[model samples]
Target: MKNIKLIIIGVLITLSSGCSPELESVNFEEISPAIFPQSEDDIEALVAAAYYPLRGAWWDGFHTTSERGVMFINDATTEILMGDFSVQLYATFHSFEPIHESVTRFYDDFYNKISANTLSIDLIENSSANENVKKIGIAEIKCARALLSYELFDMYGPLVVAPLELLKTPLNEVPLARLSNDEMVSFIEQDLLDAAEDLLPPSETNYGRFSQGMARMLLIRLYLHQKRWADVEEQANLIMAMNHYDLESDYVGLWDTQAPVDSNEVIWAIPADYAGTSENQWQLMVLPSNYPVRGGWGTIQSSWKFYDSFEADDIRKTNLIAEYVGTDGVTYNRSNPGTNMQYGPIPLKIAEDAARNTGITTVDIIVYRYADVLLSKAEAIANKNGVPSQEAIDLVNIVRNRAQLDDLLLADYADIDTFNTMILLERSHEYWCENGQYRADLIRHGKFSEYNIDLTGAASETAAHKTVYPFSLDRISEGKGEFLQNPGYN
Candidate 1:
């Protein structure tokens, strides 16, 4: 079973890295920047590093709802998996620890390229390069910086200082500084703002490059998270007005091989293809199986909590889970609705395709999309105004209409608390597999301990510093100068 899943996982990895092709090489002499000016070739090498790897652990490793359970930091899994010993004093909350520990590799990886990008930007600003190349290069840096900072913030949170001046200051001299969350967010906002102005408007050639619309989409997300209602609504309207993309009619087909790129739903996705080792989302996804029935590899399974929330009417419920009978005739289900006495449940969010005969298996992992923008706008409206405000309810209805889910009541029989609670459920139901937000959704709503029946063993936490992940000791040892080890880790 392991080997079967391994092979399937291999196919996934192969597709992701563009199936690296054997190549011929050209010879050139390398010279120091002090001796000779930077050339387009030199700039390309540096930016390529940042461009190559974009997935942070959270972004890629714990990407799906089924696998993303660890990030939620609750006791449900412990109760189910470790029934008797959950209250043990040794249990901890390391998920909240800062990410600078394990993430230094990505920083080193991208910052080196960012250094080169900075040089390229300087050349563009001062030198006699073509206007198009200069604009493109500037846009590229902004795009690259946005990607890096987004990764950084999600993992490490805001530090107290700015990150850019540390760009080329040499490893030893860099001081450890933490940007406040507000400061970190401000910097990220600035990067997208710069990109919006520097980028070409959306079109074909720019399809491969950053565009104004992408920047705006990014801004839309930032505003949503920051609770900026008006800005979120405005940006969403702007993108929708442009009409470049439409939601894929078939929800299942959004992941299907023939899923057309016709819709404006996607703003940016990590470019993936079925030819390489470095880029497959499936490498980490497929569960191994050996029976005559549809084979599957069970690396991670869905939470009973998540599966229970899905209504019978929602199409997304089908997309998020798969039910199967094992070779042993065991019904595989964890979230078996307490009513079902037998069986286990696997993630239906991604499957081994209906047509496996073609060997066409590459999955496009979405980073952000338009539906999120609308939700963000709706949430923002609710945050700024009360839950029943027409605009907030209306925006929420748009999403409900698309998903065919029920809407908030027109009459104000219940208070805002009731409406807000409904909104949270809708967001959870609709966006479960889209982002690593399901578990966080549980935490935000304070419900992991409730639905989780098997929550007793390691679910108990005795550690003093038990909210987040700890910065690994190894990261500091790897020349991460001045970076503080997160409070709870070591």
Candidate 2:
């Protein structure tokens, strides 16, 4: 891992310091493709470069698992996280506009990665490496690109994805418009499908590298968003048929410092370490500044409305701290709530890393899990059937049972609305703070604006157009009127 990081760093430096003085005067007789990617290691490093943006690094990583990351931003927009930070306040109230830095950062920082992946794919394909190496390398890069695209698309609709030809001519002033919805979906769907053909199964792949399971999982999510019920069911069942994943019996154990990176439940987790390439700073995001075990900025907290939605016996809620003794020798809870607890409970999802002297911990940042596949399958089944199905009920029970909760009876959910409500709630309880998909789930069910208004009266500002965030004002201005902002933002 360290070697891969080093190789990526070297590549970045070379790319950034274009036309070095040492090479400027010396023209090569032949710039042969054979000279580069001559071995599997070269291809591996290129693949690692594509994975860099998705890492848990604090500065530029899109999936950092911290305040600057997708999980925090997306979860904050939902009921899962509430706080006084500008981003949190804006997201929580759905009042974010095109100029808001936090809301626009994902697009501004990482959208170019789409072209980066395209360039990498072109490089790997044109390299003199063997077919097998090229196949695997291209597949990994495609998957990484597709995953990033999906996240961006979910948050801010279709993007102006520049093609490889356009990327090649850096000086060209070719302004492009965002892809239409169908074109955008097809673009991402095709990449995942093509990549899955060569991606290794979960059992065969490295812990953090993109795998066939991850590709399929992304497909399921895409299908879910499109409400393509049968498609969701098919893709989810494909993963299940691989028999490469299952739920971790102990819910909280999945997030422990000692948790296995190769757990059956985790379809994909970013392997994090305090030292380097990837870092998981979730512990520092929610823990209060004066907490006894560890101190954090206390940037965000889970709402009581969300906390109360969980059943008392649900082990998933165990990590939520309703009260805690501070290092200042003060006890705090909902009633005597200190600064942190004023909004709600401290959502310390991952176990506290007591040995850590820094903000980051060694806990793997889980992205896709087998539990999501199961729940997604259940949702697809119920929605496809247009009512509660025993199959769907059983699937939901599998997850609930892991949470140490009683099975929900099918008869109880007579209609699709009730069943969907239950499914949404179950999703909220099960996957909160993990990937921030709960907000997407709400929007999918046509309840994003309504739910926020019900939970926080101030969210009355939310509207249908707010479902997808606006393109940043700078991006629109840069487009020279060729690119248009998402509707209603104007």
Candidate 3:
């Protein structure tokens, strides 16, 4: 919270942070103990700080940070997105090592976020705010914590989660120890469950704030990762029953800044400002370096295999562009299919921007969408029943139909194995590079190793026990044996 600004605006307090250093500590004098806000607006500002890390900055010319960092590892390591020319961090992820700065930064940034949110929770609880305000504030903080912890766990497996009181203490004064996977998962689940109790339902909650549906969505994803099939099914169904969210009919238009605010498709979206400094930076990373709309570095591209995987009629393929009209009145078509270390098809999911030339794009980055819930339901049901149930088939078909693909029938699949595979492939296409869901989906389907089957250069034999990221040497040395690296890295 060192650089965090708790601005008291109209209805809600605007909270924003910049370059959140790992050792950063809040100056209590700003939000003084004597005169902190007792109103809901102030409380909302305090809670909003928890989401700052998700809207990562373009530090180092759109270098990997925040959601981009997560997507970098998730997509680059897999086949959906490939790097171009960049060498040190982003390019190396496809063949990542334990020493990679990207992994370390991701580890550090997320922990700082967890710490920041923890501080917010404690401060909110101790404040003289209304009891109802305290409840909601605390609930939102817990949800934020849960989301951050889940991201860490998804990347690093298990972690040393610092408690609120300990985080308040100077970093040097407290010793951190990694939680066992089960311990971490239990902690995450408890936070989500508690947050759900106080959080408003999706429709009632302000846009971008944590809600009951988001809590359930997180629980569903967590359960899916843990192979808690029954829990996944239960949580997914619970979110579906919220009756507030649904897949947007316009697949390409869903990411539009002008898209309806009440879009039932988005469960949780990190809203970016249209004109201010808070604009989304995603367009610069995935858009072609020469594309006229919002010329990007042309760095992140879809794999040819990925581009080929789509059915001919799938609308998503069109969204994954191979050609585009630039502001220069020049038509650009991708012909050079560079190696994994270079270019391929560009992801145009966040491509349509009216303000691309202005250095900041106003596109709202979708964190969690209803389409995922539907697909997760399909996967969960298939897993729970040990077969492709008709319900599961219908759910998968719902997504495929939206993409204008032919309807999938349970009869098309011979057994649960093939059916589950199809659902995962569907997820890969539907959610590619959309906040790193592609990587998580791969691990869940046990297809992670399939990508590792071929290797060369610095990545040879890299897939061995490398499904999870390694703790940076810096983190482990700092731990002095208290923090253990993921087993394979050392």
Candidate 4:
């Protein structure tokens, strides 16, 4: 597996920096679709390459738990995280503009992977490998492309997806416009659907690789974003019927240093190691610079408002450190917030790795899990029926029960609006620092601006137009009047 991963990384490097034709004396075996990926191992490597950008690497990986990745950026946009840095303030207070580097970072960094995956799929299809290999390879690549596209689309509305034919030619100078909203949704939906047919089931798939459940989970999320309540319920039900997943018995145990990568609850997790292809730096991101266990950069914090919102006895809240003694012999807490506590509690979602001397750890970054499916079904059922159902309430209680909270009564959440509010809050508490989908949840419920305004008092900066972020100024310039920016931005 390590050899395959290294080969994939090599493929990415070769793609980025092609062999120089100027060195004519040195014969170069140029890698291209026409010649490479002819063997089974080659096809496997190509598929693995499609999965590379989604790893936890700081430079380009999209799912790193740290500030550079989607989890931090998305969580920062909500009350889940706050910071003193310019980019953190921009995200937390909704003060982002077209020129803000952080606002444009995701798209600028990973958009090329869409075409890269497309090229991989094309190569695998044309290879002389067996039909089964080709089928599986194509499915994995499609899933990777869809996952990458969905993340980008969730932030920036549609994207300019270049065709494989166009990608094959260099210096073509053909500019493209972003897809229509429906077109973009259909494009991603079709890819996921296709991938789900060939992906291995959860019981058969490796921990970090994409599976049938992962593909369906992505569908559930996309449907939730589109407000297709019936579709969400259907997809969530399909996953539930897989009978291969369940919530972890202990809520906090999920993030322990020895947490199982193949936990029944985790649908998809990026496997990380301190020395490797992927890394998890959550401790470093939230821990104080003088923290006794492991000194960290203290880059971001959870808001006090968010901390106080949790039920006192909730086991999930145990991970959120409210007070701790620093290496300087100073206690940091809400009352005596030296430098870190003022922002809020340390949002240490993962347990402290005392043995580690570096920023990265072996903690696998959980993306989609079974609890999200249950809550999503609950939300979908209520919305689809126009009222909270007994089944819906039960689904939610399953997750709440794991948190050691009492079951919520159906009568308490009578209407769709009331039920949705409860669901949103439940989601916020359950998945805050996990994958950063709470921001999308707030936006889907039309509370993005309102919640931020109430939490941060940034009334002037919070608005409906800020629901989808603006395209970067550089992208707009490159569009040459062809690519229009998202609404409400110049």
Best by lDDT: 2
Error of 4 at 9 (Å): 12
TM-score computed on alpha carbons, candidate 2: 0.93
Cα deviation at 375, candidate 1, in Å, is 0.7
User: How does each model score on TM-score?
Assistant: 0.73, 0.93, 0.87, 0.94
- What ranges in model 4 sit over 4 Å off? 1-29, 458-460
Q: Residue by residue across 116-145, what tens digits does model 3's lDDT show?
A: 676677667777889988998899889988
- TM-score-sorted candidate list, best first: 4, 2, 3, 1
Better of 3 and 4 by TM-score: 4
Clashing pairs in 2: none
Model 1's alpha-carbon lDDT is 0.47
Comparing candidate 1 with candidate 2, which one achieves the higher TM-score? 2
Q: Which ten residues in a row have the lowest lDDT in candidate 2?
A: 1-10
Candidate 2 contains a number of clashing pairs equal to 0
Tens-digit lDDT string for candidate 1 (1-490): 0001111001112112311122212122334334322455434433333344343233433222222322222222321111111211112212233343332333333333334445445544664545666666677667766655654455444432323344334343444445567877887788788888777666542222456777787777666555567787788777767667556555555555543345456665544444432233332433335323345433433444455666777776675434545555665445432222122234445445545422224455555666676666666666556555677677777777676767755465145666666666676666544544433333344444443323323544424333223444544454345555556565
C-alpha RMSD of candidate 4? 5.4
Candidate 2 wrongly placed segments (more than 4 Å) = 1-34
- Residue 40 Cα positional deviation in candidate 2, in Å, after optimal superposition: 0.9
Instruction: Let me know the TM-score candidate 1 reaches against the reference structure.
Output: 0.73
